[model samples]
Target chain A: MSSTTVDDRSTTVTPPKTRGAGRLKDGRQRSPVAMVVMLLLVLLWITPTLGLLVTSFRTRDAAATSGWWEALWAGGWTTTNYSRVIEQADLGTAFLNGILVAVPATIIPIMFAAFAAYAFTFMDFKGKDVLFIVIVAVMVVPIQAAFQPLLDVLGPRGLGISGQYLAVWLLHTGFGMPLCIYILRNYMSSLPFSIVESARIDGCSNFQIFWKLIAPMSMPAIAAFATLQFLWVWNDLLIAKLFLTNDNTTVIVKLQQLLGTQGQGAELLTAGAFISIVLPMIVFFVLQNFLVRGMTSGAVKG
Target chain B: MTYSHSTPPVGGETAVDESDPRVDDASPEATVPSDYGLQPVKLLIGVLGVAATLWVMMNLFLAFAYHPEWFFDSKILMGTLGLVVGVGGAAVLFWFINVAIEALPRKLEHGLVPYAFLIPGFSLMALTLFYPTIQSIHYSFANRDSTEYVGLQNYRELFSEGAFWSAVLNNVLWIAIVPAVTVALGVVVAVLADKLSASSEKWAKSFIFMPMAISFVAASAIWLTTIYAYQPPGAAQTGALNAIVQQFGGTPQSWLSIDTARLNSLLLMVILVWLQTGFAMVLLSSAIKGVPEDTIEAARIDGASEWQIFWQVIIPQILGTIITVFITVVILVLKVFDIVYVLTNGRDNTNVIANMFFNEMFARGQAGRATAIVVILLIAVIPILIFQVKQFREQEATR
Candidate 1:
């Protein structure tokens, strides 16, 4: 309901008004002062990342001798940083490990949450509202509270699955499910009741209706959760570093190790930072619309 | 269709007419008679089948995990098998349960299907989150090894320790500064970017949002190397901040180590702010955009200045978003760990609760004290969780 309300408000007000009449200011009186301030702030916002990207491409001597902006014109570029970090620092293995962790971690929770969300949305069960509310409340519980016992359970004395990818995957799934279900249920309940009523009247089983109708209809929310989950798992450091083996960890953990231990590997560190960010960057840009939709759908009401 | 024909209506009012048999009608009153107790038997078989399959699925994965030598030769094989057993196994388990549920009578099937969908997810939460959370609180009452009960000793020791209080102080400082600054900056950027031409607005927002994609570790490394890198007072400073400071004839200080007035902690908070501002901006910007045009126009007609219109008109409308973004960031700040861990390693008196918990548990092997630290975090979070749930309920109620 809020999603549709937001869309209605934006559609009515956004395009025609923003063209010449500033929403905050009077008609067509464009403030050069505002423009200047925005430019300066945008520059400040982008400088650190831009500088790092430049440094990642420059030769070590060139990077040390001059600032990234200066090195831009001076022209000392190389790919050895990327090549060496991948080969010698074993970021290649870490890259593979990141995928290994992120893919399953993202998929498993989405699968489970999709089913739960469907039940919460369509099925008439006792305590359904209370159960949904509890799950929503669990979203704020910090992951730190579970770490010690989870470590014990997954460690050598219990499941003996610590230092394995399974450990991090399970931790991520458990932590990620509440938010996934929350977002998906919010999106699903907003759909019209007629479609589901019609499908049920035709004698479709709950699973048939869910798998064929609801799941397919919920792609935007699913994409949003998938992107968010993939980014979280890939970028995660504490969980991966704790649960994964040293030789087999995600790229972010590898980058942190390179940063901490080898201060001299500035080139490697810069390149590795970019290497770690590349996938999430791609996901963010490609699913940028869904990401924004997902974020606001849960937070902002009409 | 045939099953719907076997309806035995309870109470004559629910009886179906023999003249018009709409077999496809799926109303609740159309209950089928039990074929001499076979329906309950079928339900029993379905329940056992689901339970047994789920049990087998867990043991199968655990069995594979016990022997790494089976696929240890190839990392690819190991990872693929992990996905298969973990993800593929879940898919198979859910499918098996669905089929089993379908075998039951219609009434039993309807009642059980929701549980079939809910059991896997809630069971995961029960195991991973609920059980562990309770265990953590239980361990807080135990000794260092968590093997012996020590009552409130862990709490007493943690309260008495200066390091624990310092971590709490630093956490409070973080909570005080990060969310407020982030929301303020986000609002400014959102409003300003919204004023720009459409294309430039996209580029400007993207630049601000780009940092959100970078991991905290990478962002911290970037900040440490590019923005905060220090050279002793001079000699061609490499860091942007130090370089600018030298340009203004100031000394190049070790920015991260400066604890005088907790400047180092403030510096680490900047990294989180940098990473999260985009999130605040995107959400707030949309909320601002959603503010109706008539309100601003009316304010202007009433001779309100631009600033007045912004505060009195736009701000109140988007207050919901501001609170949402603020609380979201507050939760993140409360759990702040990776940046502090990667940057200072909690050195220079910059420790927070999460990092302190990590050291107490893994680095020092004091499980009781570590869980006590987590209990403190949980206590701090409870009020916020209650407020958030209440807010969500209000929203749903309005819907």
Candidate 2:
């Protein structure tokens, strides 16, 4: 942030010995130039989201003729869009369906991945390294690859489970595994080994150690994956469109459907998008630390 | 091989508090191993007992999943009850096996426990992830409805199609622009914000990070209405850009539908850049903090210019992080669907691979074409996967 002029007074005062804390205020950012540039960029980054927030509250007429900046001073608002989304559009039902989709989709993979992560980290098993590598390698396999095969397997001949929430649930369970397992494995291995050793010497079985010790001890990692999976499931459209029928629409697909001819339901769509995002935003702010950790552990390395 | 612990991950500012990891286990019983077998009578009893438990659990799960009519025909009712029974049933199954293992000779318990821990999770993966992956590759070779083996016909047609090539070109354009621009902007913000006071840094970073929490569908709506929205020449402009243009005595333009120089695709790219810049910034900001402060101080005291220190000392220190963020964002951009699907539905030169794949599969009912697209997408990701694995190994080795 050194903002002081780069010591033109150098000839006047060279101090007896070098002081690490120079008079120059870290000029990279201490200057007003840095503050203005960063703030302008930040404002530019959020303008779209902010525009929607403002426009969502304005009346349809007000939103069309003028910008969000103008609507602030003119003072016009309506709750009709929100009401229409909830009552007439059946967004509430879709939200309920979203819960149905997101809950099991989140818990199933996390629990399953936790078990796999525990065994892979704390216990010795055959083909462990090779198996773990294959699983993690598939982490990069985009969700598109799994959809066609899933359709066949869940078809009448394979399992006859299509159009069922259970089918979608199981699809997410499988699809979510590689990343969740990777995150949990990294976190579990970081846990103190002495805890496992002491518990082992105390005559606790490996199953007991995993369930009683590792599962609870890995709560941060577990929470990280849970937040991520929940957001992903809640926000997902591709998986829902491929797996669920029209009768089983989640909130996201419902919002996409609300996009009438050329987004004619701009008001309703705007409010509807808000309704879909509210839950995940709440989850994100509350567990952002874990989200950051889980994301880095799974995708990025030091 | 020893497990890598606490390698000081980006954003994981606090390392695990472990002075001594598990090399200290010296117990004699832990060292003793036993062959895994029970007597015939015990084995028979255990197998039948576990089999009965699994059979009952399966029936219960099926009943909950299938008999929604009895549960008032509510999907929520069926889902909740099924989850309860499924999870409760699983816990009971695990407890049952643990008790059975305890009944066996004590030395044999260790041999079986690890496999026991692995069974449920691995089975789920086997049924869902592992099986579907193999099946998807198989469908890539079949005909449209997947009823016959076409033998590379789908791939041949896909590669030759104009629409397919357009999708690929758009994908390449998006991947080329979005990640590079996002990382460049993100690094600037991260470096600038780091130089600010702590409170200002937090505020500025949070504003940039706000878009990450919203869904892409929602993000598309925000941009579609607020920025890229269009109207007829006579009507009032709803989109902010066109409105501003009109206010400045220019013509209102349909931003997303405009075709001069592929402006529509670039418009779609802006939405992604907006969403991902936040993610890049957060990770890169944490990484900036991880750069040792004393090194910068040394450079400063040695009369190095701020630009010189940033270029020489800071950027090199965080190159690993820049690559990590870039790759993550690239993967996201390659599968970019919701934005295109929501805003333009891949119309007007905005088609990308994922959107094309979805349209071919669902709208056109071409399963073979769809799976072929999926296989292509999977193939595109393999080099990145190899790079990721190499990075992971390097991490392990360095740790």
Candidate 3:
């Protein structure tokens, strides 16, 4: 009833106004002050990243002698900056480890959340609302709380899952669940009631309706969810560093390790950090559309 | 947060039925499965599911228990096989149980089905989140090894110490400064960027939003180069801030280590503000676009200037989004671990709650004190969480 009331109220205010004026975007106003202000903001925002990017390619002497902007005009670049980190700094191994941890970490949450979402949407289960509410609120539980107990439980004492890929994967799944299930259920439940009603009227079982009817329909949401989760797990350093404590874990964690032990030769950090950064940059561009879906869908990945 | 699409992209996500294609009147898959019969078949399905689930969970357990050797001690091999078997095996397990639950007799199916679907997810949260969370609380009240019950001594000790108080003070400074400044910058940038010509607007926003996608550790490295890389006297300053400082005949004080002016904590806050502003921008930019067209036009028609229109019309409409962005950043600020750990390891009086938690547990082996820090972090998070949940529910009701 609230939904219907909201819908009815919106229709009354839209049509007459739209008929008189074109959409707001069609009307354009440009001001030089606004443009300059925007440019300044953009510059301020991107200065650190741009400076780092240029420094990543510069040789040690060039980087040390001048700032990145100055070095750009002063001319000196090397391909070895990239390869040296990969070959010598063990970034290549770290990169592979990132992929290894990220792939399964990404998949586990999406699948578990999907099946559970199907139940939440289509099945007539008691305590469903309460359960969903509790789980959704679990999104805010500082996973920092989980670390010590998790370490103790899994730390060769209880389950012996610490430092393994499985440890990270399972932890990621748990961390990802509240938001993933919330997004997925919201997406799935929006399917036309007519299709589901017809399926039920024809006596299709709940699982049949979920698999044959709901799963395919939910692919876009799944893809959107997966892309965000993959990036979250990939770029995450804290959780991976804790769980995958071994030398070969994630590129970002390894990059931090590089920063720690190899504090000298600061130019190496620029290249090593970029090596860790490049893949996520690609993912951001490739799955660009889903990110909008991800944001409004819920769970802002920080 | 980095990925705000080119268009003024918001609002379509909340309303999901907008483009639903109508199904044909009679679909073929809907035609079968009227009768609930074959008791033997049902029993077989249930038994198979239970056995297979145990097998799958067992494999997962053994895989972790004997890791580095489970797949012949190779990372690549372990990664590949773990994905295949984990995914394939989980799929089979989920499918079997889903079927087994559906085939149960009418009397118990309704009660059991929800729990069946819920068991894996619930148990995971219980195992990984709730169980650990409870243990953390218990450990907070216990001694270093957690073998001795120290009661409130850890909390008393934590409450009394100046180092702990400084961490709290720095965190307070962070939450106070970072959210307000980041939100103001985001709002201003969003409004200004919204005024840009279509061709370059996205690029301008993308440039600002770039840091959101990178890891904080990498951001630390970048910021170290940009602002914090300190050199001894007579050394050429490579850091941008120091280079500029030297240009004006000032010194390149180690910006990260100096507490003379509380510069180090403020510098750390700037890194957060830098990382978070883009997220705030993208979300607030979309929320700006979502402001009704007629409202701003009406303000302009009423002889309002650009600034008046922005403040009067746009800000009111998107205040909810600003609050949402603010709370999100607050939560992030509370969990501020990676940056502090990577850059200074909370040295020079730059510690926050999360960094303190790590310092106590892993670095110092003080479980009770560590859990207290964690509990402190959780207490800080709860009010903001309640606000977020209320926001979500209100949004849902409108849908």
Candidate 4:
């Protein structure tokens, strides 16, 4: 939304120069204490995930007998846990279902919101301001408000789409629309309107202007929302749990199921946890820049 | 002012006047601008055509949505069919509506076309969010299955339950602690990371931010097995905290079961803090980076220490970002369910309102009370909603 300001702000960041004896030209000392504290905090943050990652490779006996650190020091690791978790937990199907649910859920809303955003940004319509405000206000409404009723609406007696992937897809698209429209509209508004004006002057219709002019220009914001939505849907458990039955459960749900109540099958859980997180972790690192931009621009997810 | 295209503007004079220089010889349809007498009929026909197309689209969509078992019994096939019909069909709908709006009388087309683009998204919102939200509130007043009206009985029952109050208190603790602590640590990480060499900063931030990508269920699993795991006094401790405790000649304690004074609840809050601190850092880091370097330079020239400059100079500049990050996290915390759901499922008095709602509705089948909890949650969020609208207006002002 604040794309221009973000660009301006980022460009103004001071380029790093080599620090000799921890001093910068700006009179701010680069303290070694800060670096050490930063490193320690970083270690503290990453250790939990690292421990599980290590344990995921260890055998059940070794994991029960020793800490993950011991396995790290020794050379007792195997790929068996992953394979067993996949086979026993049926995480393979869940992983596929995660993809099946996430892709359309991401694209459908973005497409619809992009068109709506174009109208909100470039066209004059009655009640546009009020409608835009309503969309923004929807950003804060907890999805819980729509939870039970959406179930009723989509259940067999209503639309008969419950337990199917279409149910969650529709729910995700609906829940995602506000932020999508908000982000894309903010971005489209920031775009230079002269191009749109010229296209309109050349007798281009609103549809033509949206497709030929605004859509290409809004790619950065679109990509940002797309990445954010995909991740949110993939990591989501609440909506998926409430909507999809066991037959179409996503990976996150399967991981929870595999954990069991008393934390039975800890071996499988340690491995299954890694399996569930791997795709999202990959997506996060690969799209880290877009993720940051999307977050800063008010892509809040719960 | 121009009609160089095919169709004539409805209920208007001939579009291509010989006196006008914009007359087109390029397209043959432009020569038929003499059809002005029947323009209203064309407009009627266009509207009816678009309406019928919309009806057919809805029927087709409902057919696909309602009967997946009929579509060869594979969700993949039904999903593909639904996606095509849903997305592709909407595109076609918008095209048809815009085409119909082209024959909208005179300047009405100008005003109507935007609505054509807006119909699908708003319709979806109306169905999925707005209507259901009202239905939820209505069901709060109704009986369990929403079959009969029961007034405020659900509210009274929920307010009287100790478990509900415990959930409320735990939620209060979470709201009071998580957002503030996450933002504080985030600012600290952002400032500390900013001082390092660029490569070191990237690696450090990556470690801190890495938790954000994983699901809360996975996060809970990571912590439950790695950090919160416990064993008997003599058995070797596998969990990190227990192992460290045993190394100090102390008994290994079950961290999550220590609910005395809500310690376990506080421990569960740690997982959310760990997961969310990275989000806060990324936002605040950019805010920190956005602060003009010369301001810090000027603060230093005035003999202020780095701490003083950070407090007096940098904090003021990034206050907007801090508030933004703070409110966002607060909203997230208000809806906190997964960590609690996966870790303890509200056992040992760790219940939050969201988990309470989940158990009440799905686990216990108390739809009335569940909707009541949601209504209460909605009430709690109303203030934040108003504040956010104000905040958004301020941001829009700056824009």
Candidate 5:
């Protein structure tokens, strides 16, 4: 009814809105001022990233000799740093390991959270309210506290769960579940009840309703949570360093070692940083549209 | 702009017949079997799960007792058992809860479903999060190696130590500086980006948002290599900042090493501001978009100056979002480790609470002091955490 009402209202206002042309004239007059302000803001915002990019491409010699902006006219660009980075550092292996760790780390939490969120939003059970509150409240517990205990559990002597991918995966899932469920539950709870009821009337079981109806409908939220988790895991250095051993170490941990204890090896650092940054950039670019749509869809009911 | 896709017919019209046999025509009632078989099935699954858990436990005990060498030799057997039992038990419990919810009456079912979904996550959180938090507080009162209970000694030492005081002061400086600068820069960018036309706006926002995807460690490495990186004067500088100084015939300086009182620490703060700017930009950008159009129009109609309108009308409307972003940044600043740890390793007066905690705990093996530092951090963070939770709830309610 609201959708139809909005459509009808917009249709009636169209011809009159064309006749009210003063707004366009006023907007056009302000355009130049707006453009200048925007350019300045863009310049300010991009300065650091531009500096990093320029420095990454420059020769270590050139980079050490001048600011990145000086390279604009100097024409001293070289791919030698990249070559040295690739040759000297095991970036290829690190990149593969990062993907290995990040993909499952992202997917597992999302899968678990979605099921949990659907149950939280749509189902009724005893102690449901208290349980949901407890989960949400867990967001306050700084993750660092869990590091030692989880390490003990994953270590050689305690739980004796050493040198295993599943240890890290399960820990990541446990850590990620709280925020993921909080966000996804909030989103799923706001979905129209009529649709769910109709699905039930159509003899859809709860799992079928979740799989065929809720999952597809909640894609935007899913994508948002997945993107956030992917980035968090991809960028994570501490967890990987602590839980994963030498061979299974993620890109960030490898980069930390490559940078070395005293922070030498700038060439390797730059290349390693770039290698790590590329996937998240691609993910962001691909999912950019869904991001804004997802945020509003979940956070705003209307 | 519109292309090939057909719009669905409107006015609540039924486009398909219900009698079509291709589709399942069973009503909700018909779908439910009269035999009530689900309960028995659920009971069977639960029993199987418990039995399997018991079997694994028995095998583990036998291995530990009789075949100790075999147990010691086989890593895969131990890991596999742990996985099957842990993951399997969880899955079974989840399924049982689902079945129970399905068995409930409609009104009760609706209320219970969401909690069922939340239980697994909550259980995990309770174990990993809440348990350790309580444990940390307990450890704080113990001796250096946690071998003896030295009640209040750690806390007393924490309050008395000069480095601890310096850390407190530095954290205060971080809390004061990082959030204010980040929020201000973010608001300015968000406001300016909002004024642009659609095409240019996305590009500008993307540039601002790009840094956000970078891991703190990677960003720190990049900054260390390019910006704050300094090489000695004679060695042919490899850092970007030093290179620029060399080109200008100025002596190269280690920007991170500068102990110009607190300026080196300030440089570390700059890196945080750079990393967080993107986070602030995205949230503030959305908040700017959410500003009621009529308010801006009214301000303009009143002949308010552009600056006045921005500072007065726009700022007031988005103050809540601003505080939300600010508080989030504050919490992040409190937990900041990668930058300080990587860049300076808490050397040259850059030590904060988190780095101190890590250094004391793992490096020095002073678990009591480390736990004390963590408890301090937890105490400091509690108010901000409360505020954040409250803000999130309020925002949710408004939505």
Candidate 6:
């Protein structure tokens, strides 16, 4: 929360008898050059996104005929691409499916993880160290490795739970639980143990203790994980392709479908891409403070 | 026992003694321990009671079933059983353990509570992850069809194949180029954005971070439309780059098709760099922000130039974060598939290990070779994993 501003005039200042005299001389000399360089850097970073935005607005012919910068002078833009994308792609259904999968996927793991994290941090039991390590080690295994095995389980021979929302939801929860537990456990362990002991002595059951005490305290971490998991599931394409079929496809999958083999009608792609990006942007903005807090909190000392 | 003191009204404040046996005791005989045998006997009875109830319910359904076919079908039986037993059973067991943990005496609770919570997660992880990983290793040594024993043959073929070597080399190029470029660009952008004024800073950071939100498939689609062949001659190019070229009176060219000695493949790498730059930027930006302002001011006061301050003061302080970002990017680049799969379908020298695995498994129907590729990729990642673990420990110690 603290902002540390460097002295701008430090370059022109010589060492003085006092710290105040030294800071005063440096504060005056360095501000202008810093401002100019910062402005240039900002411009460089903004150019590409500006180009993408401008190209999305202009007609295909005008876009191809001139640089995105030229669109400023040409002054012709339309929403035809957006309309075409909406009409051609099943954007609505895909977006709904994305929400259906992402919301539960985010919530379930956080729920399971919080309880497990509490137990790991506060409770003592046999084989606790080995169990915790096993969970942590699962993080190293790539999702691709599990794809076949998961399909085998979901397919006809095993659970026979193919092509349903539950399949993808379970897969996401399973994959997400390890890191969620790891972060939540670390955070929960750092809380004051005296409070927990007092609650136990007051005859509070474990579930009651978790629901009333631990959950309220870990809201910041839970919110942080929710933002991350939501973004990941929303942008995910492979798992959706693998598990969800036809009407169950997510927005990202729908965007992929919009682009033909040669990407011929793909000027529509820019609009579709933007549509898919909108929700995540909103989520990030809404939870921006918690997101920053969680990152710093959960960077896990490592 | 004959005479008692007047009792306080209900809800009146009363101090309870810490070692009061008569009030706190659960046993009929307050001085004696309850029979320990009764505990396990009750647990056994509860478990059997639930199992018996499930059995009777299943039989009754079968006996008077409207959907008799469902009961007869093995698949249905197995599915129902798996759901009830696998997921539901786990939930039940978790609940039982949670209850038992609370019942433990205060002195023993600390030692038993964590294990009770961990049992379910560990069991599921073992069943789904650890078991499969071991299965994969076993599968690696088997024959292509996995029908017969063929020890070392797959490993031999893996080492000798030209395509395998090409995939390895491409992976090397990817590891070298993607992470290095992404980190460098990310650092530059992060530093620049940090220097910007408030309004411009938001706009710049948002622009750089935009690609991070796009799916790999969507981003690839965007690039494919923009850079690949979409020219219709007199109609003008829809791709922004080729359009710019045409405006300058140069002929429009398919940038992705330019196989001027693997330049096309490198162009594919560019899309990845663009997509990942935001990730690197965000991490490094925070790292840069964490640099102590006093250090920079002190350097400037000591006659250090702007370049000198950046190189000496800022970079050194953030080197650990830079390494973290670098390793993350490397892992991503190693698993690079979606872009190559979507953009060019691994043509024009763009194929990496992952795409090759997918091609062999799904496209070519060579499960043996596909599994082989996966095993090789896993092995390659091991050294990186070890390094990451070491870094993690070091960081933990400092914290």
Per-model TM against the reference = 0.90, 0.88, 0.89, 0.91, 0.81, 0.79
How would you class the docking of model 4?
Answer: medium
Rank candidates by DockQ, best first: 4, 1, 2, 3, 5, 6
List residue ranges in candidate 1 displaced over 4 A. Answer: A1-29, A73-76, A299-302, B1-52, B84-88
lDDT per residue for candidate 5 within A1-302, as digits (tens), equals: 13345445655765654534332221322355667876876676566566667777877667666666767975568777677776667676667667766776677666667788877676656665666655645666567766655555557656654445556666777888877787787778778877777666555656678878898988878888777778888888778877777766778887777766544676557767887888988987888765554433332110
Candidate 1, residues A1-302, lDDT tens digits: the string is 24445545665666664655443322245667768888898888888888888889988887776767677577789989999889878998899889988988888888889899988888888778789888877888888899889989999878888987778878898988898998899899888767877666565666778878999999999988887888888889889988998866899989988888755788899999989989999989888888887787654210
> What are the per-residue Cα lDDT tens digits for candidate 3 across B1-399?
011112212332333232222212143422222223224466588769868776877676566547556557788887777777767766777777766765654445556766777787777778888899888988999999889999999999999999999999999999999999999999988888877655567778877877767888998988988667776645678787887788788877788888866789899889988988888888898888888889988998999998898888889999988888888788778788899998999899998888999889888989889998888888887887787778777876787
TM-score of chain B of each: 0.88, 0.85, 0.88, 0.88, 0.77, 0.78
Poorly placed runs, candidate 4 (over 4 Å):
A1-29, A73-75, A261-263, B1-71
Q: Go through the candidates in order and give each one's DockQ.
A: 0.46, 0.39, 0.35, 0.51, 0.28, 0.23
The lowest-lDDT stretch of 10 consecutive residues in candidate 1 chain B is B1-10
Measured by DockQ, the strongest candidate is 4
Best by TM-score: 4
- Top candidate by lDDT: 4
What shift in Å separates residue B75 of candidate 2 from its native position after superposition? 3.6
- The DockQ of predicted model 5 stands at 0.28
Which residues of candidate 2, in runs, are more than 4 Å off? A1-29, A300-302, B1-53, B100-112
Clashing pairs in 3: none
TM-score of 1: 0.90
Query: Across residues B1-399, which tens digit of lDDT does each residue of candidate 5 receive?
Result: 111122122323334333333224354532333212224444456456545654664455334324536757443454354445445545555566666665543444555566656656666666667776787788888987666899999999999898998888889999999999999998988887666645576788887777778888878877776566666786666565677788799998878778677988898888888877877888888888788889988999999998999999999989987886787678778888878877777888888888898788768878888888888888887786667556666765686
Q: Which 10 residues in a row give candidate 5 chain B its minimum summed lDDT?
A: B1-10
TM-score of chain A of each: 0.87, 0.85, 0.87, 0.90, 0.84, 0.85
Native contacts present in each candidate (fraction):
0.59, 0.56, 0.64, 0.66, 0.39, 0.24
Interface RMSD of the candidates, in order:
5.1, 6.4, 9.1, 4.3, 9.4, 9.2
How good is chain A of candidate 2, measured by TM-score?
A: 0.85
